[model samples]
Target: MSYRVSVTTIEKFRRYMTEASTFDTEESLLDSIKGFFLGNDKTKFGEAWGKIIEEGHKFKHVSGNLNGYLVDGIFFSEELARPAVEFAAAHPKMIYEVPVAKEYEVNGMTILVSGRTDGIEGNITRDTKCKFRTPDFQEYVDSYQWRFYLDMLNAKTFYYDVFEVQGFDSLVYDKKGIAWLHDINIIPYEPLYCSSYSDMHDDCKLLLRQFFEYIEEKNLYQFLKPYKSNA
Candidate 1:
């Protein structure tokens, strides 16, 4: 049977390769690794912010009440949405929530990689990230997610639109004790044209093949267990 995986999953496997021994069983380890892709509070807020930005970009030409178009009320407050909205207004050409997917054959196994990019404009693909502190641009460049997006989209440039919203006075952060203002910065890095692009692609494929082999070997034991549970 063919296995479906995403770039995020591949990245998680790479990260937890050495730490899998921490889990009690292979099934538990797999479940915990899968949890990395699940939505959490931080990701939820980032999605909300991205939605507000997309809405603002879509309706930038319209006049009158923009608040009605923006995401507001309990979930998304004015403070949190303001900068994203403002940024969207400034750059109206950005296409939001673009879905990109592609399948590859690695070591005789079908690997399906897919992701929804935050935005894409011209030859550049952009990902909006909200964080409590400034992020390292090199980390973004080195990330498997970014590399996958670049390869799938065939994009020339990749930009990380990082919104450092540490000090925004919102109810979301009332008790968290984060009170230092930060700025939104767009850090652009060229991926496809990089000197190490070919090498990186080779490394990713090898890592993925190793992951699939490990999973298949582990699952074989489950199938060959002596006793089966009736419950």
Candidate 2:
């Protein structure tokens, strides 16, 4: 089946469909990181930020078209559109967009998830990634952000594809501490998520759920107790 998403959602996380998570508190330094990224387009970024402020923080911009590549609305080279079209042509399975919970509020502070899923198939859900530069394995792992999405879906397994075009040359070391690089086409074998992967993803869900509960009830001290002790 064909698919489409909000232009805002599609544009917001131009790199990945979703972000990592919302700020822990309004004073958190995460805003700085956001500023750094959004600063890439000073003109558009300023306009958008001004809108956010003017709207009394009630509304934020988001894009729905997350799956498609971020190319000009026109296809200048058959060489370029070839891959995007090829992917859709090959994956005849119907794709769909799913809204998974990520954002949460802590003491009137909005802390939500920072990511979105491109779409889902019968068993394999998919995300569209356009990487101009090579993505290390850690970068690849980070892209999955499976913990958040899987938690929302309450599923055990998932399959993802990373579509890369020229520029990537290095690999990233995953948490398991393995490093892998891309030497051939970006579309390598699908990463398999065994039971171990499921358990880890489930743990993230539990973490977020507990975090939301604590914040929703105004339990900041108790909510941050664990982190403080660990630190």
Candidate 3:
């Protein structure tokens, strides 16, 4: 049978495995993946900035103000506006929001793993994040998302462009005296390396097998019923 799973869900499943030891088989893993779907939802900031970063990657020139476009009660502040525009203008040729998928056979079942990269230019895949604090490069290096992106995109290097958000109490102004209240600054982090590509690939394959086994044993479809009705 064909099973569809996202990278974020896979990450959550991995986290669940750490807390609960019940998912020892593929059936349980699949159920766990679907069981925690509601809890795995992205934050408003994550959703908003993700779109902005995707647009920046795709457009060569963005006219008008980005602050005009808001999603889920989140908007680009003055601090982020200039940099967002600049990043887009700078990388006109980069591929944005590229969907990628890789399929694996886990215990005779088809498991399709999928994700989308923020941007890709040359041999590097870039992921942008609007963070409240500085990003840890080592964390990214060990991330499942990073590894999956590398394997699926066939990227030589993975780069994270993290924007640190600075909030202000009073009204802030730009050089032109335009009211821009938030300050978004880019932090430094080196590109991550997949030194042991083969090992990572094998690990993912094993995870997929375990995930499917857990699902088969646990009847994961029951948890998905509520979500389907809501949809």
The root-mean-square deviation over C-alpha atoms between each candidate and the true structure, in angstroms, is 8.4, 15.4, 7.9
- Put down candidate 2 lDDT per residue, 128-215, tens digits, no spaces: 5444444454554644355455545666556555444453344344564433223324333344342226366545544444444434
* TM-score on alpha carbons, each prediction: 0.66, 0.45, 0.66
In order, what lDDT does every prediction score? Answer: 0.58, 0.39, 0.59
Model 2: C-alpha RMSD to truth? 15.4
For the record, the alpha-carbon RMSD of candidate 1 to the native fold, in angstroms, is 8.4
- In terms of lDDT, the poorest run of 10 residues in model 1 is 221-230
Ranking 2 against 3 by TM-score, winner: 3
Candidate 3 lDDT over residue span 1-231, tens digit each: 466777866765665665433534445445546554232112445555566555633322222654333433344554455565666676778898888887766686566788888888888788876555555555555567777777766555777776655552333345644443245444433444443366777788887777656656766744432111111
lDDT of 3 at 128: 78
Query: Model 1 segments beyond 4 Å from truth?
Result: 18-29, 32-38, 57-80, 167-196, 220-231
Q: Over 4 Å off in model 2, which ranges?
A: 1-29, 32-76, 102-115, 142-144, 167-198, 205-231
CA shift of 212, model 3, Å: 2.4
- Sequence-dependent TM-score of model 1: 0.66
